[model samples]
Target chain A: MGRIYKKPVSMTKIAMRYCPGCGHSIAHRLIAEVIDELDIRERAVGIAPVGCSVFLDEYMDCDMIQVPHGRGCASATGMKRVRPDLIVFSYQGDGDLAAIGTAETIHAATRSENFTVIFINNAIYGMTGGQQAPTTMPGQKTTTNPYGREVKVHGYPIKVCEMLSALDGPIYLERVAVNNVPNVLKAKRAIKKAFQIQLDGLGFTLVEILSPCPTGWGVIPKKACEYVDEKMSKYYPLGVYKDLTKKK
Target chain B: MKNMEKYKMGEKVLMKGNEALAEGAVRAGCRFFAGYPITPQNEIPEYLSWRIFEVGGTFIQSESEIAAINMIFGVAACGVRGMTSSSGCGISLKQEGISYIASAELPFFYANIIRGGPGLGNIAPAQSDYFQATRGGGHGDYRVIVLAPNSVTEMGNFPKLAYDLADKYRNPCMVLADGLLGQMMEPMEFNFDWVDPDKLPPKDYIVTGCKGRPRRIINTLHMIPSILEKHNWHLYEKYQRIEENEVRFEGCNLEDAEIVIVAYGTSARISTEAVIKGRKKGIKVGLFRPITLWPFPKKAINELADRVKKLLVVEMNMGQMVEDVEIAVSGKSAIHFLGRPGGSLPTGDEVLDKVEEILSKPASPERERGK
Candidate 1:
């Protein structure tokens, strides 16, 4: 059959391993499509942290090193400093970045390491049986937070883009969503722009993408997208939190 | 603005053991160092701050021990020598990354200035982490090439040896020394020039932009169970080669000795004095020092097992290396252990007293030689 549009070459031939309609597949495709378009697949080096995204090695074609819990950003920092020729990036989740890896994320950004960070914030720990993540909604119930999350006990959800925007080191910081066709298009552009900033040899750049996690949310795939739009978006508003490139 | 530090090339220079380790890395073609400040190993990063940069390498004082090890992982994955160092507790924090490095089979050299521990233990010298160092500190079926250096000279010398052994097996190598060794100063000479990057072979697995080659993925996440098993076996086979080819030890007066002291690191240095004192007292005693602690000098110990009547194992820990000595002796000789953990060191006279006590005990006649 003549090809009208085929899968991105940056993604491997292996079948997708995420749950049906999970936003990970779409996000992975967005990144792969960006790498292919930029023509940097040969020089791209990605670090996969210990989470559901650990399976990224199976899909991402460029050089990769799967690190332990919460060390993706630190690993990418090391790779980028030593091999500035390679385009380095780290793909992380809410639990990996906001909680377990908070030190690495903040330090890497404060150091202004020239790499891209694609943070997928689904408001819950999708791997390891749906535990409460640092980004879990105030009233959201999870395995660890069996009862609906209470404000006094569970604390508030972390707005990563908002928190990181306070820092002066990062050159670009934006929050996007992949809840619908319009949002998906914005998310893809945000991901591509973050990578472009790195290609320009600028400082730290990150895109926080609010995506749907159907199995973790205990909802059908279609409803999960609506939930991301209606619920998650209310607390984690989508916008460009910081844009040093425009200021420059 | 050149700093006050200056030394003539190839001339003997007085250096601290930890600083010697840093200098050794520069001479060994190490290009990256990512470390956090710990008690005894603080000077390593301090020395490397200018040394690595002066040699046209990179140095990153990571936010924490966990971050430093992961940074080393990145440097190693990109195909160059990288290192991180800490004390016992900081090393405990680094176990997860160490496991990943071992599983991924990246080559690098790290130095551990053994300090007292169980928690945020004291800053004094202690070897209580022998099990953690030798038996694969991380969670996996893997062993690092462990080199236990006794003097500041060994500190200046072991980095090249450790890095070479690491690249030989594509495994992490550890330069195991105690806080005393790190604190002491000694004059030493280097075998090669310090700024020569062309000395060692270029990394074959380095992912330097992957020019005409297929994009490479240096990963350790094997989803399939059988695939992981195969990787483990591949590592095991490599370890076997290491065990066979790299067993190293130092023995003094073994042929005529009735009692042999088995030790390594700082304890071994003291034990050598004990051997000397015992020999002066007309007691038949000797020292068997293990230079390589992981693929332990078992072959030599097994051979010496036939000669010695009893082996007195001395250490600055609560008897960590005794277990390996026991394994090597294989019930061929009686093994006696004397240790002082928690930052206390057994003196040479104290070890001599223990040697005398063991020497006074009549040799059991029924002990079969080489059972």
Candidate 2:
């Protein structure tokens, strides 16, 4: 009998440096698997952001560039515009995507740049020792907000998929979680569909994976998965925000 | 010369400095341009908006100066000639990405049509960004080749030089001009034929795809302290070579000069006029203009300081490059400064008068400061 499971050829043999229970490794695997399944590993280029995923080049066995904080989409836009035949995607974390890179994120979508964005929204700043993030839930405790996030002072969490869905430029937008086996499979499918849309020469496509950061969240790996399903999923619902391919 | 015929575009055409420089970049194989609109340099993006499409290149009026510079960083990483342009505060915004590109060792090109500034200063011709441009202009210990173009013709021709040097060194190169040069109209001719970027030799480091080879990664993060230190040392050595081999300057009547005026960009143009007027009045004034700001023409200035009695460093700022001149002179000659900061331009008469006053004075020990 054939092997039941195997690593994707697009993934490097190097062990990821992510903390235990950090969803970055899984998210990276999903992207690598998607690239392999599409058979576009030879022409795929990834742009890594400045947060925890800055070392993304070590995990993805494809042409990749690590861009400055929040400038991944801008760099990816440059790569795509110059070489339209090549597949390009930018992998960014919550702070790297929603906070500092808000303008880059919004404008790239506004222009409908032909590229893919694999946004990992773990709702906290992982690399910087659990600092308050742009998507931090109200009352969520963090290193910066030692007394818990106050809505009046800290403001509301940004809903990236919902905010971006309002724009007409992007051809696809989806938010999926990686809490359970089924949800992980669904995330892989969404990631693959985003890449397929890019392959078909569609406009901007983004997949926001509600990842887990157990260490940042001050929880165990098992508890973090439960927290994602019970709390994070309720706030950031798991569904397609927009899909140009679907008819009204 | 036989080579001249290859690049000769026949007759000179009248063109604004910003538009001509934009055309020059396209002719020099810059296929990607991303810039934001700012005073004194807006024509650069405006021209390239339609012009880039004509050559089947990419033009993006990027969301911000940060995005624009990063876009060039992206294209340059792909081993393609790409550029961006902005002025003053806009350039301040681009420094973050510039540092990253320099650290990654990507060949990049850009231009700065400097306007008055500290914060949203008026859009007038100024060279206040001298220290910012020459001192790496960013957080890291990196250097960018800064070419100061004084005239419209030089503005039109310098992009080719900037791109060639950037590619040769795999570093950032910038054409540093001021609002005067960017807006002024002059008859200029192209120095080279339109280059086809496709014909350029393929670079092995570009990120096109892995295909049959091992994948390539372009990055600047060296988490390990020792590894990062080694990388910094590598950049330092490259800069050392650049300083040794790439120092460039243009001097006139230095053989028998009593006073030499050290200047660049708009100040250089004004000082050139002062030199001519001083010569007519038998003042024996010569002009020394630096073309490359970083890797500044220091050794030559040090040598020239020995022969001249006094060196007058003129600028459109509150004496920025004058500091470099002093370092190079190192007490060899009496130094004087004439500056007009904040949207002000020094007239030829004012500079000539300053030169005459310095010559008349009895070599004071302190060497007069800024006027």
Candidate 3:
């Protein structure tokens, strides 16, 4: 008999509670694989925010703290201060991170808090059944905007990675997508690098992954991935937003 | 009798209220101090920065009040004694962090040296933060143990007491003072035993979690509304326990008194002198000084109500603590309120006149005659 492939050690045997074909599971698996590869499972502390990834604490086989909605950055800041030895990371969705928690995230980065932030930007609020998010592209239709998002009324989408990269405190900032296998591989690398930056005691490092929300986008799972490639990628261009490693 | 160590309690010294509070925190085993400098309370952080460095402790000047408070939250989450001091406007910025600390059940200390106003209140001392401190300032339903210190000595001692109380109850505690107490220079003595954070029992419930034991979790999440209701009830029950166990008050010449004056913090100091003046003028008056404002000394006042005919509640704010006194007296005595707001401190003469006026009223003429 041939050897069987095993699931990532960082992933628990507990079944994920995410909806079928949701990209959150993929992102979770990628992060878990990185954790297992880096051998940081025992020392890793995950901060899970409210939204679809609220149960990221359960899925990831590591110690976790569930922060209040829009407070993941503050909670993670606290955790990082206490346990500077441990690798702390905050997993936040677009609405939770970019909208309500904007100040916390921006300031934490500006203060150069040594932690990793895994920002999953799906462009819409998924957990609350498809509401408009800060990163939702113009003309994108959400439950709250049945007439499509109006630029005059709602303002343009926030480019968090680009905006944060301009700040001096962040040691690493990158935006990656997880719609395809190639992008998935790149995202894993970016996630691993973000953790490694924290391990090096470097300042804040965030990897904003443009993920797909099949259920929230009102499209088939395959079409959701295609939609991210054709539509979302144009609005939020991929590639490294900032990297301090190559500076000196 | 000759060979003994004298108990050094209540010895006066010349020290700023903020400096005394910093000294008190250090003596109380506060190893972590993170704060941003704000008016009327900047001396606290400045003193801690110098003193904490001398004692081989962490002293971080955070980016802002928001960051400073969050840092304290982090240190407290690690089960270390941590504290932060700020004035009115800065404290407003810390509400979110305070709410998180409460939910996480982290015991920490905070010092609020109040200043004037509804906006960027003046740097001058005021008791405007009464509502924010006593009541829940944040969104959620929560309570913090608030200790109002009147003198520099009390300011120095309350930090230690606040730390002990916070640890014992597993809740955040506040040492509430105003500009007078924050900036004044007075004598203070440290008598409380030092707490060695290293020798303390291990905090298994801390976020550090069980390294070699079962996975431990500290959280305030209750998905079910029923569970949340139960949790809130449990918190209230703990508050009730605190109210029963930790009510502190000082009764000065309450026996055979014609009138009782209720006051706290700096106001209490003035009220004491006023009571003395009233006594010299043949008015039999006493002062009730509340040390712990939250777990108020209700039973003590209730007991004193039978002895006194009239009650006057004197405060720096516009009749805030008067409400508490009324609740305690329960209509047994006529409670007269005297207050000076907007950075103004009430003088001894002002309080004396208020007490005399309440005593000489036609309703209490018998009490006035006895005086």
lDDT of 3 by residue, B1-371 (tens): 12111224455567888988888887777777877788889899888887876655777776667767766766776677888989988889888778877877789999999988669868788877877887757768888889998888788889888988898888899998999889888667766755556666666567663345443445556678999898888888888999999988888988878888888888889998998888898888888888888888889988888767588777777778777777887877777777777888888998897776776674442211111
Identify the superior model by lDDT, candidate 1 or candidate 2.
2
Which residue window of length 10 is worst by lDDT in model 3 chain A? A74-83
Per-residue accuracy of model 2 over B245-312 as CA lDDT, tens digit each: 89889999888999899999889899989999989989899999999999899899999987886888
Q: Write the per-residue lDDT of candidate 1 for residues B244-287, one digit (tens) a residue.
A: 99988898978799999999989999998998888998889999
Model 2 chain A: weakest 10-residue lDDT segment is A239-248
Q: iRMS of every model, one decimal?
A: 1.3, 0.7, 2.9
**TM-score for every candidate vs. truth?**
0.95, 0.98, 0.91
True contacts recovered per prediction: 0.77, 0.82, 0.20
**Model 1 lDDT at residue B34:** 91
For candidate 2, what is the total of clashing residue pairs? 0
Go through the candidates in order and give the C-alpha RMSD of each one to the true structure: 3.2, 2.4, 4.4
Cα displacement (angstroms), candidate 3, residue B155, comes to 1.3
lDDT of 2 by residue, A82-195 (tens): 989889999999999899999999999989998999999988999989999999998889999988889999999999999999998999999998888999999999999999
